[model samples]
Target: MKKIAVILSGSGVFDGAEIHESVLALHAVEKAGATWHCFAPNVEQLHVVNHLTGEATEESRNVLVEAARIARGIIEDVAKLNVDDFDALLVPGGFGAAKNLTDFAINGAECSINADVAAACRAFKDAKKPAGYLCIAPVIIPMVYPESVKGTIGNDDGTAAGFNGLGGQHVDCPVDDIVFDEENNVLSTPAYMLANSISGAASGIEKLVTKLVALA
Candidate 1:
């Protein structure tokens, strides 16, 4: 079985935007019959504020852990178990993860870079293991493997400008279609617009998953 590490932002608050892609990715991986491990940044508290009422809420308290701790746990789990044990790294898109880090960093972007995560990603690339990213998750790819080719699918006309800045080739298409490079690496989606098109996104995800499993 090919093992994959699924990375997620530790924000317990389930914003409609964040949960959709993550859940979809999870579903796709499972449907493909691949093994996966879940990873999340740790926070002492996760707050959820009501948009209308402005009331602040927090998740249940537990032993407080910092982002570094959680990231370390990911590394430890990967290492102790062996990197070759896993076939690839999977990152899910969410606001909290994107906000705090340029590419999975913590502490308002000023924190020490998590070289471990970067190293793991590099290892995957060097090994030719298939990597998967959805939505904003692709933002982490350029940071980790700048030389890798990438393609974006869906109507990101306005957002495509920003992606071009990252040196990614943006293809104008519906998010439902799968976009890929010649090597068949999975790429970005029109996640910003395709939130309601669950069926479309699922089809795209299925295509990506099929390609990735073939690589493995």
Candidate 2:
């Protein structure tokens, strides 16, 4: 069986991982007959936000703990992730991906990836394992892999420009489609980046999981 390592950012869409995207990815992976393990960095989130009001909150949370909510408390610290044991890696997008995994939300093209997160992704890259990045998670791809790659986060002009500036080629895609980087064995999809509904996001995510499994 192909084992995939899934990296989560946090718990919510505003402050952490997009709950829907995270869950959808998990569902697709399982339905494809592949097992997966979840992981997250054991570090403080950049900030907390109220999902209802979309305002900053006084609360603080750890990335791993919050991410655990999505994994149903079954996850590991990203720092200890052994890439050799997993056939592929997958990242679900939310603001948490930007603020926690990489500073792309705040720094855009100049964003810096969290050390542990980058290390985990790089380990898979070094082993030549294929990976899938969803939503904004693709922004950090250039940091983990040297080759200029193709990816997508919907068709937002400014965000796509950021990917280009960071040594990646951002392909414009709809929520139900995927951008495949053949040379790098990487797959990326828009997910909630353009989806107006959960089913819409599922289309691309499911395709990504199937393709990733094949690559693995």
Candidate 3:
């Protein structure tokens, strides 16, 4: 069986991994006959957000601990992820991706990715393995691959610009579609970036997972 490594940011959409996207991607992986292993950086979140009110709160939380909430406790520190053990990589989007995986949410084009996250992702690229990024998580693609790697964030002009600024070739993709950088062996989709509903997001996510597993 193909083993896919999933890097989640946190447990919520506002400050962590988008739960829906994460769950949907995992389900799709399993349905594709692929097994998934979840990982997260062992660091503090940039800031906590009250998902209820969409406001920042004064609290501290470990990225891995919060991410475990979504993983149902079956997760590990990203630093322990060995690219050789996995066939492909998948990173589901949520504010936690930008906030914890990389500082794209705050620094945009100038963001710096967490060391372990960068190492794990770049390991896949260096090994020529296929990988997929969903929603805002594509922001990490440019930071991982070479210049002009094609990616998408569901046609958000500002985010697209940031992606381009970071040396990526941003493509306008819809909620039910994906942008594949065949040359780089990378894939991206606009999950919640354009989806107004779960089924809408699943359309592209399912396609992405199917293609991702096939590529693996």
What is the Cα-based TM-score of model 2?
A: 0.98
Q: How many residue pairs clash in each candidate at the backbone level?
A: 0, 0, 1
What is the C-alpha lDDT profile of model 1 across 1-216, one tens digit per residue? 777776655432232124556566767777888866765433332344454565656644321132223334433322233457788767655543444223322332222323444566667767777777666555555555554356553564644544555555666656666556556354555553455666766666666665666566
For model 3, residues 168-190, the per-residue Cα lDDT tens digits are 99999989999999999999999
TM-score of each: 0.69, 0.98, 0.99
What shift in Å separates residue 108 of candidate 1 from its native position after superposition? 13
lDDT of 2 by residue, 1-216 (tens): 889999999999987889999999999889989999999999999999988899999988999999999999989999989988899999999999999998899999988999999999999888889999998888988877775788888899999999988998888998888998888888999998899999998999999999998889
Residue 50, model 3, lDDT: 94
Best by lDDT: 3
Q: Considering TM-score, which of the candidate structures 2 and 3 is the better prediction for this target?
A: 3
lDDT of 1: 0.53
Q: What are the lDDT scores of the predictions, listed in order?
A: 0.53, 0.91, 0.97
| Residue pairs that clash (backbone atoms under 3 angstroms), model 3 | 10-17
Superposed model 3: Cα runs more than 4 Å off: none
How many backbone collisions does model 3 have?
1
